[model samples]
Target: MTSTAREAELLPAEDAATYAEWFACLAEPTRVRLLQAVAVAGSKSVGELTEQLGISQSTCSHHVRKLAEVGFVALNKQGTTTRVSINPACCTGLPHAADAVMGVLAPRPCCPDNLACDVTVRPLEAGDWSAVRRIYAEGIATGNATFETEVPTRRALESKWLPGHRWVAELEGEIAGWAAASQVSNRTCYAGVAETSVYVGDAFRERGVGKALLHKQVTAADTDGLWTLQTSIFPENRASLALHHSAGFRTVGFRERIAKHRGIWRDTVLLERRRSVESPE
Candidate 1:
């Protein structure tokens, strides 16, 4: 195994202890339910949580104190009422902690299983622009793909997408979908992090075209030494979410009321996948 893999397999002693402390605080079923209640309600008074959880006030108070000690929940005082709210950091940190404990945090090889064998994924060629943009247009029409009203011009897309990381999927020799990674920032420090986008043509919605394209896209990103890939997906797009999750992506957080799409507010699910271990230089 590579040194990077070894490092991922073993968490630091200090971190393990810290994580253990946090986990220990939530060992009780009541504490877990308490945290969940606070997380969903955003904030709740002790009495409110007690009533919602069907637990006694004293028992709820004791468990809330335990969770607060580990920074899982925060306490606020307004007049005589003490309200408990979940620590926003825990929203992302705890999931990452779970991923670390389970070996899924480590990057693995391409995961193109049970995909349609006839669908071919190839690097985007110059002649593929027409089909690529047409597919993008289809995605725009769905009102769930992106906030953009129209497909970006080919020149604009080419300049934004990272060279050598653009791809096209073909079903029976016709372009069915496309995937590409765009540099998230111009700073040298963020060169390895990218925001990715994928779209399937209207005719190719459920034929495993997305699964095949993502397999090629993620594998290529790993080989090219990219360390992080992130994407924002509309919460309503369940198919896209499942596809990315299969490729090792995890939900980092939800951006509620994040932006306006067509004159109405919309929420987005922010997701990211980090390289499991560094590839050899």
Candidate 2:
């Protein structure tokens, strides 16, 4: 009907009808704003959405219904309030929108070119703890990696890496990053879940060392039958957050004032990635 809608119809056809519906649903400025709000707030009820966006209840309900009609949202009645969540299927299909939005917003890649540094990822060994500890300590000294007061000894660090779950990144024979999974909880019920930790040397930050280590660690953990991998990250750690997000972890929730650091309370965000027997492409 509209030029934009016609253009959307002519675009590639991975899911033509679905994309048409999504395009029609998103064509409205109000609806686009509403979806942006929901993406930022995770989920919201009609009343909450209205209050936040300064729209009337009927208007908010109308836009939400349009979103649901296009399969972009799901509504659950919670007594007098209705809760809405972004449909995972639709959310996963939104990369086109993301790219378009980025074209207008960022317009430039954050890291356009890769570093020329030589790096390698391999199975971590017991003998590597000294180098690992030193790298980790350097990260700690910069206040960017961990909250641990002191670096662990070789035995202490080795005890944490369970069989079938160890990987490290090396740069010119020096350990740059390491990642391993530990039992999520002492309780047996949580045995299938494990919490993962990754640390990269300060000198190797943003050089792809963390990404390499995560790929190897996640692959090993998945092969070992770990169903869920989790981590707690300080809210201020943007690089670590980007690494986990790129590796497919989703932010589940946040804990307020979970730890005290540098004489101030710090919040931690919880992130998790579900691993299946099938490897990721």
Candidate 2 ranges with C-alpha deviation above 4 Å: 1-117, 277-281
Which candidate has the highest lDDT of all?
Answer: 1
Top model number, TM-score: 1
Pairs of colliding residues, candidate 1:
107-276
Candidate RMSDs in order: 5.8, 8.4
Clashes of each: 1, 0
Between which residue pairs do clashes occur in model 2? Answer: none
Worst 10 residues of 2 by lDDT: 103-112
Residue 64 accuracy (lDDT) in model 2? 96
lDDT per residue as tens, model 2, 104-178: 222222122343358787888868877778877886786645667688777776677676787788987788888
